[model samples]
Target: MVLSELAARLNCAEYKNWVKAGHCLLLLRSCLQGFVGREVLSFHRGLLAEAPGLSPSATCRGGSRCSPRARQVIKCRNEIMHSSEMKVSSTWLRDFQIKIQNFLNEFRNIPEIVAVYSRIEQLLTSDWAVHIPEEDQRDGYEGETGSYLSASQVNEVKIELLKEELEEMYLQAEEQEMLPEEISNRLEVMKEFLRNNEDLRNGLREDMQKLDSLHPPNPKRDSKEPGRETPERKD
Candidate 1:
C-alpha cells in the first residue's frame, strides 16, 4: 500500500510515528476530490483552507515562500489523483514519488509541519464520513461512507451542499457582527477539539520529558523570539 511505503520511507522514529498523519493527508485529498468530483486547484485550495491548520508551508529552512519542493508535492498529488485527458506521464510520477519521500523526510523534522499533520489527522479521524462521497471509492480508497450518487452526479450535490453551509455561516457571522479576521480565525478553530490541540498536547509532553531535545531553553531565544515557539497561554 502507498501508506506502508510512505511509512517505510520515513525511517526515523519521529517519522514512523507521523505515518498516521501522512495517511491522513492522503485520505483528505481523496475525500475532497471524490466529494467535489473535480480535480481543479481552486477546489483543492478551498477544501484545505476550510480545514483547520492544514496549509502547505510557503517557507522552509529559511528559503523562499512556496518553495519548489512543496510546490512539486502539490502538483504531483493533483496530477496523479486527477488524471484526465492529459494524463500524467509515468516518468513524472516516478520522480514525484522520490520528491514526496524526500519531502516527508524534511517535513518530519519541522515542528510546525508536525503540528499541521496532527491537526489534520484529528479532523479526518473525527468526522470524515460527512464529507466524502461513496461513489468516489476507488481500489485503494477506504473511507467510512456509502455511495450516494454516481461520480457524474456528485459535483452538483456537493456544490449545493457547500453553498448552503457557506450561506448559513455568513448569516451567523453577520448576526454576531464578527469582523472578517475574527471570523476567519474562529473557522480554523472550529474543526478541532480544545483538549486535543497540538500546543496543549506538546506542552504536556514537554513537561514529562526527562530532557529537552530542542536544547536548553535559551532566554535569548525565549518564546518571544519569532519562529522559536508558539505564544504561551495560561492554563
Candidate 2:
C-alpha cells in the first residue's frame, strides 16, 4: 500500500522533487547509521569524516562534532519538515544532492546501498535537485543554521593539542639529556672499583700460598735421633 502510493507520487512531477529528496535523505541517513551503527543526527558530517577510518579511540569517545555541510543539511531537513508549504529551490536542491552524494561517498565500498544510491544519483536528472533556495530563505543561512564549530575555533584547538605534544616531548628530552652522562660515568667508576677489588683479593691469596710453601712446618723428631734424649720415666 505504501509503495503503491509512493510510486504514484513519484509518477507525478509536482511531488516528485520532494518525494525523491526525502527518500534520498532517508536512505543517506540509513546508510550512515548502518556504517556507523549509531545515532548520527547529533554529529552527521563529523561522524562521516571519522567513519571511514573508524577507530576504537573514536568509538570510545562518543560525542560527535558536526561538519558545516552536515549542519546545513540538517537545517534543510528541519525547514522542510516544519514549513507548511514544504518547498525547496533548485540551487538548494542541487547543494543538497551534492551534500548527500559526498556524504555517501565516504563509505563507498563498505555498504552496498551506498554504491547503489551513488550510481542512482549520477544517472538521475538534476530535476530532482530542482528546488529553489529563496523558498527556504526564512529557515536560516550558513552561519546561522546549526550549532557547529567555526573554522578558526577548530584550528585553535588543533594548535593547542599540537602544542601539548611538543611540550611533552621537550620535557622528556630535557630529563634524558640532564643525567645520562652523569649516570653512565658513575656506572663505569663502580665497575672499575669492583675489578680492582677482585684483582687485590686474587693477589693476596697467591702471596699467602707462596709463603706457606717457602716455610714448611718443622717435622716431628723420633725418640731414637742422636740429638734427642728421653726424659726420666715419670708416673
Candidate 3:
C-alpha cells in the first residue's frame, strides 16, 4: 500500500509497475532515487549505527537517532526473520504496532493507505484456530471460516516452515559438498508443490528463486522420458 502510494506521489511513471515484490524495503530503496540514505540503507535500517541517510524523513527522528522508529521496526523485522522462529512476544508486537502506526500516520493523507492500520489491528488481534481434520470430519462439525486467520497467513506459514527446513538441509549438504538423496527428493517435492499452488508460489516468489539457485534444476533430465535416464559423462 505504502510503496504504490509513494510511487504515485513521486510521479515515478517509468517504474510504476514494480509492485508485490517480497523484498519489501529493497524494492522501495530502488525507487527512492536517493530520497533517503542512499548506500547505507542496510545499516541504517539495522538500528545499530547512526547515519545521516535515513535522517530528517517523515518517519525517522533526525539528529537524535538513539532509536529512530523506522529503524526500530526494521530491526525487529530482521530479528523475527533471522531468528528463524518467526515469533515475537505480545509486548514486542504492541511496541511494533505503536512505531509502525506512527510511520503510517505520516502518510495519513492517503486514505486508502491509512485504512491499513485498522486491517493490521484486526489481523493482530484475531484468533487463529487450528484445523483438525479428524475432529472436523465428525458428522456434526460446524465451523466458521471467518473465525480464523486469513488464508494467506496460514498458507504463508506452512510454506515458510517447509522452506526453513529445506533451506537448513540444503545448507548442511552444501557445506558437506554433497546433496543427500533425501534432501534432493524433498527439494523436488517442494518445487512441485509450489508449482501447483499459485498463492504460495507468488507469496514466496523471491524465496523460491533463492532456493532454486541453491540447487539448480536439470532441464534436460526433467524433460526426458519417465523410464529413460540421462547418462552421466565422465572425463
Candidate 4:
C-alpha cells in the first residue's frame, strides 16, 4: 500500500490494533537497521583501509560512494534475490523467520496484549499485597488494647475526671474561706471609695470646662489696652 493510504488506515479506530502492531514492528526494524548499518559501516571502513592508497580517514569518507552502474546492479540483484530468500531454508534465517512469525501472531492476538497488561498490573499490586497484613494475625497487643476502649467506658472515665476536679476545687475553697463580716465590710468600703472617686472626677471636669469658658480669646486686646500705641505715620 501507498504510505499515505497506510497512514490513513492507521488513523481509523477499526485498524488501531494493526496500526499499533505495525508501528512497533517499524520501530524494531529501524533500530535493527541502524545497528546493522553501523556494524556494516565499521567493517567496510576497516576493509577500505586495507585497499591501496586509502588511509583510515579516506576510507571513512568514501566508503559508501559507489558508481551509478554499481548502484543499478545492486538494486536489480536485491529485487531478484530478496523475495526468493523468504522461501529459502537456512539455520539463521529459520530463526529469524520463526521470530517474525511469532511477532505476527502476537500482533494479531489482542488477548496477548491484555494478558501482558494484566501480568503488569498483578506485579504492581503484589507490593500492595505485601504491605497488607494477614487476617489471622493481630497487628499488635498495645494497639488492640487501645482500640478496645468502649464508648461508655470512655464517657465514664471523663465523668470521673470531672468529679475529681470539682472535689479538689471544693476542698481548696473550704480550706481558704474568708470571714463573713470582713468580706461584707470590704464590699461596703469599695462601694464608698468608688462613689467618692466618681464625684471628684465629675467636679474636676466641670471646673476645667468653666476655666476654658472664662479664658475666651480677645482679638482687640492691643487696641483696648491703656498703654497700647497706635501706628505711626511713615513721614
Provide the overall lDDT of each model, using Cα atoms, as 2-decimal numbers: 0.40, 0.46, 0.47, 0.35
lDDT of 1 at 204: 35
* Winning model by TM-score: 3
Candidate 4 regions exceeding 4 Å error are 1-14, 54-235
lDDT of 1: 0.40
What TM-score would each prediction reach against the true structure?
A: 0.23, 0.35, 0.37, 0.20
List the candidate numbers ranked by lDDT, top first: 3, 2, 1, 4
In terms of lDDT, model 2 sits at: 0.46
Writing each residue's lDDT as its tens digit, candidate 3 over 1-235 gives 3223222222332111111111222322333344344436764556534554545342644674534766865675455434332234556655655665665566466544454545554443433232333332221123442234223444445455555555665676678555556556666766675555555556567666665676676556467788878999989
Residue 23 of model 3, lDDT score: 22
State the displacement of the C-alpha of residue 11, model 3, in Å, after optimal TM-score superposition.
46
- Flag clash pairs in model 1: 58-66
Error of 4 at 108 (Å): 23
Best by lDDT: 3
Model 1 agreement with the true structure over 125-227: per-residue lDDT tens digits: 4322222233233322234532222222222332332233334445556576656555455333422322323322332342223222222333563446666
Better of 1 and 2 by lDDT: 2
Per-candidate clashes come to 1, 7, 1, 0
Off by over 4 Å in 2: 1-14, 38-63, 119-235
Total colliding residue pairs, candidate 3: 1
Worst 10 residues of 2 by lDDT: 137-146
